[model samples]
Target chain A: MQNDIILEATGLTKEFLGFVAVKDVNLRVRRHSIHALIGPNGAGKTTCFNLLTHFLVPTSGRIRFNGVDITGRSPAAIARMGLVRSFQISAVFPHLTVRDNVRVALQRPLRNSFQFWRSDSMLDRLNDRALALIEAVGLAPYAGLPAVELPYGRKRALEIATTLALEPEMLLLDEPMAGLAHEDIDRIAQLIRKVAADRTVLMVEHNMSVVADLSDTITVLARGEKLAEGPYAEVSKHPQVIEAYVGTGHG
Target chain B: MSTRNVGFLLLAVALVAPWVAYPVFLMTALCFALFACAFNLLIGYAGLMSFGHAMFFGLAGYVCGHAIKVWGWPPELAMLGGALAAGALGVVTGALAIRRQGIYFAMITLAFSQMVYFFCLQAPFTGGEDGLQGIPRSPMLGGLLPVHNDMVLYYVVLAIFLFGFGAIYRIIHSPFGQVLKAIRENEQRAVSLGYNADRYKLVAFILSATLAGLAGSLKAVVMQFATLTDVTAAMSGEVVLMALVGGIGTIFGPVVGAVIIITMQNYLAATGEWVLVIQGVIFVAIVLAFRKGIVGEIADRWRAYSAGSRK
Candidate 1:
């Protein structure tokens, strides 16, 4: 009775031209779970992420988030419904400072996103929250720095901080630990652990250690299809998942 | 100096300028400055490079001309009518153009602009090739103020330009401006943050178009004619040139750009058609020499110099 899944995708499929990119994949992300979607390089994990987040329309599938069908929603509308996705390559607003980047997300809830008539000083109220989120991701020192000037690893942190500012119910991270330094990886892992305390996290992560350490459930995909699903320990030992990774030299 | 002080200084300069310069020329440049500023709001702030903005400016001019000449409307009412008509056009064209990205967006806008131009060419109100001529410079606010005096009209034009420029300045610095910057910088990221990016883009496009219309309305009143030349594709390119030369994103960049380009064209008028050649050369030179634009480059240098001095 306690198992109320937050996101449910059934028969999700996507085709580009004549080739199928993501085929008949079903995924369910539970409430407040650290779910890691893992697979080899050519896996349809990215496509699947796009479909669930409404960044790409599924070729044929129904996606129900919070038990409501959200098949045709715009990405922004989907995000407003509390499902936010971070881009694969850090999606920081390059010209804006770290604080302003977070503020962009915080201002969404204000709904005056187009109050061009009013002065910007009204937005000063959001500064404290923006700064807090900046600090939450250990970006307080670089808070004044333009996001373009931030180091590669720090941009990822800023991206997460911005997503956090939205107070999303579910945060879908596309390759969160992709290009981080070893130290950054651990810190981000800690941050993810902290973030998942109150919200659901469904991340497509390449780092197996982070996957093993953080995920409550792991879903593996290979060649545009779900190969296996379960806890990391159990799925890592699955013959198909092992063959999928080892077969592609991602072992 | 603070932005507030700078704004006041610019205002003082504008007030004093018409006395020193030719009032007609000054008013003309002021109208174009406002036009360029409105254009910059899209390209500079919103990162929407619209190549069809002449549609708004020219359309408003014709509308204002018709209102004043045919309807016998006051200048104030005519200007308002022109700007509102342009704003309405923006709503339609903006909805069509904002969804597209990069070149496609530019093309859509340009196409819409061409459509507007053709409409103006055939529309009985525009007088086709002859243009709407001998338009009277009407009084302001139903005889509250006389604007028939060239000098008085100069001030009126200055006021209109200032209002438009101030509105643009406020928009850029507002919460809405912050969101526009976000959308401009990374649209996908903005959307991911629950921003309806297209809606914001459409709003920005409309604002730009409306302000451009205001500029056109002012120009028609000041010049006493709404010509086919005003609505041409080349006019659209001229605004872009002004913004690029002055400073694409910086306040007062487009004004400076408009002044410089307009002055050059006025002075080079003796060169006949070669004035266009000189403009093209300057545009290319500016583009090549200062990629960040004149104001942007100067600001960068100033920052570096001040930082060095501090050291």
Candidate 2:
């Protein structure tokens, strides 16, 4: 496999009040590869994701995305540059219809989303594309239903569908399989694989089996630092990595 | 009945309302209705609530009253000037207030409007407590009807109200409006989707403020006077009350809300100090019984019934 780094973070650290949530972590996400960040509870997995996505300002660090320095950039600007992050919790627009939720994600491409004079019927042009996205996520049956009305697993699908609608070059999935049931997990794993086919994915997942199955490289974070990094087979066998998980009585 | 059909029925009532009822009273309700609707656009659809909305409403009244009295400008031009003035103010205040969220945002707007209220008090053109009086009502469509006729003035105010209402309706149904709803639902998710949520918010703020200014200008022209009452903090609360009584997010809720509230105040004048106590009781009763406001409750029931019938 061609190993070109698509996203690189150097010495990323974040301090909240006086507490250091994330400390001196360097990460390299490969081009068109699945990179997983996993750790037990209180390991700063979500904080690290926020720092990389510029949602949280780092106390000290540098981040280069596709070779461009993106530190201190606005979240919206980072997203426009094709680095999109999904929330760890289900974050679909609850009151909007499933199709309308997808359509909102499509709005970022337009130069202006502020034509207050025109009727929404003019947006029929986007209906086909929005419907296509909804179908891909297995949410076609619930297209007209309000997102809040969907079952939890279906809401996750809608959230991912909304994220995918942005057509990001690098997708950051924060615990994509965090709350899924057994059947839902398999479908999401399949969807993730399908989406990561032509794009890079960096995910923070706690599901060990999922981490083992889907990751090209697993970066094990323990107590705000990288404990080990490599293929899941090699990293899983690392002495300190094993000790960190076992000592903490983790899953 | 469909919302569209209900809308048509309301329109029919408004057309002949002046002939049957007191024209001035109907015109006053229409102005307040437009004001409440403009206020609703921010709080209802955009999830923004400004406690200082009277700043926009009052400033436009001052500007419109001044223009008619001093510049000798026609009615249309005065209203346009008033709306543009409010829009300009919106741009300045919205840019600053959107820096914070929730209560901070509300406080920022309230602070800005408090400053504006004091400015209007001391400003030479505002006439301070007396306000700008004798704002002449110009001929509708350049002498299309008698300028002195309350019916003609009624039609002009109605035209302005319809225009504002139509614009707001278009905004609420447009692609832009959908984005606002998205932001309202989850601002963080909206931002992550590459929307400069602040920009959308500022645009909505400006639009809402401009329509509110139009309402204020109409009130000045109708009453032939723009008083300090229009710009007071109490006026802001009154608009919010109207929205709550009608339904915060429903389109026609503001109109229904404004009419009911205004009618209560107007007809209850005989009781003097008891009017306030009576209005309070009635308001509490409506809020307690109809949590969604009248139209919102009615709309919800209608939706549930229709869905049940289909099943």
Candidate 3:
């Protein structure tokens, strides 16, 4: 394992009754790099994210973040430690203005949790930071709009901005470009590059082109077990990864 | 109309309404206004449906009644004492009840409130069926002036109602309140945002319950008694009806709902059980035919019209 490792999972396992959703999986994420996890449907990509982020406790295995043993910690605790995940669904307060949504997300890191009486100006600096991020993700035009009224693609972009507001050292993005238009995919792909410049990025994506374009390394899973792990070019040509993709196409 | 402006207008009308009508009726409206507004805090903003608010209300009344009649404390101190006591209960109950979400949360709170009701019925301090009677209102602060004057008491209650309403207004606009709204929309996301969502919800519940306690304690002082009527499940149902009829989520909706219901109760006092049946019909009508209630429907229509015209 590298000394600069940001996230490490060793023998991570999860089971629902008799069914094993994820079993004996090992993942290592380096600091300041985009690592993509690709797999077929129901191949436990999401379950792995859930286990790593503590949204779901592992039936067995261990997760380490920034050298801390965070296997059984709550989601809130893990997030506070700068490990955050963006949802597959847009997770935002639809009734709140977009600016307020990001502002609240930033407020958590400032240690001002109970200062309800302070004016928004106390958060003016944070709001500025959020606005800059919103613009960075191509959402400046919808800054004042309620999140619910935004188009689906825009909402997904907003979710990324909100997650970034948490100031995480590592981001676990679950299918960030799953249902976006091609142009939007290119736009978010660029945004992901800008984000990966300063943070460790581990993403679950089904878009093979995006995986090949963005990932410094790729890990492929089939039936809750690692089939291949290497550079994107290397993994794409690997016999096991190719067979998993092709076999599933025929199966 | 905006909620703050509507709330102010109602306060203006309430302050003077007593001059033309019976003092007791106006006072009754004021108490229920605070009650409804407090209940609205939980339902409207936090997206919590508490069918057990009357537990805080009646529990505060019982505490106030005991302090005044048995402990012989003055009225202001008595009410303050009751508010604090009820706030403590709110924290404990909220801590437990907020563990569940949606309908499960509602059922947990309602079940806990029923236990409180049974405690009141059998508790010696509650005076059972007879309740605590012949309680004194005394004077404000330290009997600085006579409270026997109904007009003076009316102004006192009005001031408290406005203060509570203003507090609710401030909270909903505050960042903490925004987080509560976030939790209501999506708990999983709020948690991932590093918010202790459960702690925020519990705080909201305690604040609402404490204010509801203030209303209940004031009622005990005004009426000079605490009775089983205050603690009954029917009182809980009535407040929920008020929130539903006015608009569950809007700030002023509860006050509007309360005034309407109180006025109806006063005029139809002679109608016997038909009053219960009539109220039920209104609740059903509001839920089935007009899901937005009075204020919500108007707001929705206004938003639609504005959006359409802008296009």
TM per candidate: 0.98, 0.97, 0.96
Q: Model 3, range B7-45, lDDT digits (tens) per residue? A: 568667877787899887888888888999999999898
Model 2 CA deviation exceeding 4 Å by range: A1-3, A248-251
lDDT of 2 by residue, B1-311 (tens): 98789989999999999889999999999999999999999999999988889999999999988998899888788988998898999999989998888899889999988888999999999999988988887775677756578988888789889999999999999889989999999999999999989999999999999999999988888998988888888888899899999999999999999999999999999989997798788789989999989999999999999999999
Maximum-DockQ candidate: 1
Candidate 1 docking quality: incorrect, acceptable, medium or high: high
lDDT of 2 by residue, A1-251 (tens): 22388899999998999888888999999999999999889899999999988889999999999889999999999999999999988998999999999999987687547887888887778889999999999988899999999988898899889889889999999999988999999999999999999999999999999989999999999889988999999998888988888874564
Which sections of candidate 1 miss by over 4 Å?
A248-251
Q: CA lDDT of A120 in candidate 1?
A: 89
Q: After superposition, how far is residue B295 of candidate 3 from its true place, in Å?
A: 1.8
Per-residue lDDT of B69 in model 1: 98
Reference-based lDDT, residue B6, model 1: 68
Best-to-worst order by TM-score is: 1, 2, 3
DockQ computed for model 1 against the true two-chain complex using alpha carbons: 0.92
Task: List per-prediction Cα lDDT, in the order shown.
Answer: 0.92, 0.91, 0.87
How do the residues B143-261 of candidate 1 rate in per-residue lDDT, one tens digit apiece? Answer: 76789898888888887888899899999989999999999999989988888888888999999999999999999999999999889899988998999999999997898899999
Rank list by lDDT: 1, 2, 3
